[model samples]
Target: MAQPPPATMRAIAIRDGGWRFEEVPVPVPGPDQVLVRTHAAALNRADLLVLDGSYTVNPALAAREQPIAGMDGMGEVAAVGKRVPTTSVGDRVMYMATSAFADFIAIDHRLLMPVPLTLSAVQAAATPSAAITEYDALIVQGGLREGQHVLVLGAATGVGVLATQIAHYAGAATVIGSSTDPVKRTRLDRYGVHVAIDTRRPDWAATVLDATGGHGADLVIDHLGGNALVQALSATAVGGTIVHLGHLAGRHAEIDLDQLGRRRVRLIGSTFRTRTREELFAIAAETASALRPALTEGAIAPAVDRVFPFSQAEYAAAYLTSGQAFGKVVLDFA
Candidate 1:
């Protein structure tokens, strides 16, 4: 059934550093693109960064009166462009990118991944951003190997949780996680963490070392930069890898150069902005393929802490900023 989309659809618009619903023209897919009618979307740390003007938006989009927001979405293919070979109208899918806060989005078909039947629209929407990030950090960049010990800093975060799972699935001998919240720390094992340490403790690194039998971790996924980064460096084993994916704690840090040099640490910084469109498409394709089995078999899942109505995006953003939620906060368009 070919259904004609309305001329305009509601979108969460960024205005005066906040979000509000506004009407925007429904986009038509270009060649090699697909038109999606979104049913759900998820919030990310980038969303907060963008909303606060800390992260720059696309120049052309920033010039708009009301630029759309969001990075992950689940939807049905309402239309497929002429050059799109793999996608067809009516297939359920999920994707990762900005400007997904809109009701309908036209995006490159190559970026779309088939939504597994076991997941709901909200769960599907929650997967792309968190999954791709962890896959890139833990597996691709960090080079986690079977039987190696791994540590996930800020383990209560949505990305942190996924990173732990990826490490576990990769056959890590031990998985250590850190969280400031005791309640959140208690839930880390469910995400495949063998030990959860309170990051607030001054002796947190000692606990991690004890858990790993004083060998330190083979790989460290550091979401918190600043002091946490310094601590993570200390916890990393000689010749180990530490992938710095976020600076949620603080941007600036004074690290020990002598120690870093002695440890032979491979510190890698990663972000979506550094990748070109073609590169992102490739990463999306690779990540989707690698995780499809786990996703389809119900072995891995995104931990959604709360789901808000699409119209209540403002509330959702506030909730995300509160830091009370344990997992991804999603917007339900249903």
Candidate 2:
């Protein structure tokens, strides 16, 4: 490959106590790694948590994980390393990295997956991280089975939409979703959501219970923590499993163990970035294969509500805070 251009690339950085845009040295793939020329990197609520130092992160991992503040992106291989024949220069690929909000990022070759020739860069960028979490929480952790009724809270968020879609594909009998905004309710059908209710409404929980004929949901995916968990618990039936995937609602939650005890409820916490290499790759491969058809058919694609040029990353993060987006807010490198 031709020599890389004069070393620097634009990146978003968190240092001291603020977000800054700076020209940092371009990342070069280490042995067992591949370099991605970022086309777009998506943002999540967790970025704010990392920025405010409010999220749980292994300090040791941060040294490997911080600096760049996002976890998903799409890019082409600019270079490759020894022992990494899984990819090559000019090959289009998608992968999640700790600090992905940059023009380029170096990731282990094993972490990279070939992008389908039919998919756009933005679509390829959308699959990693969030989508994988939903796969793990619902497919692996919750042990979802065909014909099960699944309830997805925060259904319009990045993970919620993906989870709902996955559930639909997995043969879920009834799929119900919630959004704080009534406007979001109208679009749930796109993700195959059977029932979409405004969570802010007084009787929304009752609606969910009724939707399932009082037997309650067989699986519940909770993105909003705190009270949402409690509400989900109420909507969950005996022998049900509730997977806690995110805390966009609030940090602390109150659980009535009495209800849990009587019902045999299982609450699981899932984070994609923290899992071992083998575990993540396995989930990614399965979800990728299963969802590929939906993606090709346009039934499942990353919903990009807003696209900000890569330079305007902080503004993008602020936009997420306003909760104006029902889907992902992506940082465009082009």
Candidate 3:
């Protein structure tokens, strides 16, 4: 028999403008939720925004007295609600959820994904958010087709690495990835990037155009917004789609309206922040169905740049902010 969960658990939270551990009550599973005992949690750039009170997905969270940190995690299911039918108590699962940087998290069961047998806990922890985001950006929103040209901006990022691999795995004819750092551009080759460009150069878009025989990219996955958004327009094919997944550069941008109109480009904005539970559930289901095989076969995997003990989360955040990490940063609870 599985041991019962303790009444309280330690969670990472922002206090006095810094991350620290606090003891909080362990959440009980609601009728449709599952209680997971987390082994590891992954960090995202948004976590930094949340820490500094610069971002909040929901308005309610901004008003909270103490908001726990973290977005996704990997763990063993410790308990399930009566309404959760497919998941059992011992299932190893990875999921996207609020307050994930804790010993326990109660999440909607539908959001849980089975941890692939090939992945360790740290790798599993790095998978959910990046995988789902790239899957949705490339396959769903961007409408990528076989043999089409795909471009990923900030290609060495956690989701960026996955985007390049996914575009290649999905049979893109040529996969182009961009990074401002020359070193990271070289590393992108291992993640199925066929063409690596340094976006810092003035002619980067022209280089993309040259690579595509002046036709531009069929689908563009953009993580850097602001000025990059304008450049992406120059690099995109007529009637192509650009899925704006993040704005690590800057949220606001001024672009040439004439170029967008002339090309008939489709600019889509995607985020989990404001999505309803039903929408998130559907995305999770589609991503799992489409990408699980690739994961099982080891064709695509999350790039974990570093792992820090949960107590060193502050340092982890520092490392990520320093722009030295090429992929995901994870926190190991054990």
lDDT string for model 1 (1-334, tens) is 6788999999988888878789989987889788999999999888989877788654322212347899889999998899999898899999986678988988888888889899899999999989998998988888888999999998888888888888888899999998899899999999999999987788888887898898999999999998999988778889999899888789998999999999999989988775766777888899989999888887788999999999898899889999998879999998
lDDT of each: 0.87, 0.79, 0.89
Writing each residue's lDDT as its tens digit, candidate 3 over 1-334 gives 8999999999987777567889988888888888999999999998898767777754321212347788879999999999998999989999877688889988888888899899999999999999999998898888899999999999999989999999999999999999999888889989999999988798899999999999999999999998888899999999999999888888999989999999999999998878777888898888988889999999999899999999889899999999999999999999
Model 3 TM-score is 0.96
lDDT of 2 at 178: 90
Q: Ranking by TM-score, best first?
A: 1, 3, 2
Models ranked on lDDT: 3, 1, 2
| Worst 10-residue lDDT window, candidate 1 | 57-66
**Model 1, residue pairs in steric clash:** none
Per-candidate TM-score against the hidden true structure: 0.96, 0.93, 0.96
Error of 1 at 333 (Å): 0.5
The lDDT leader among the candidates is 3
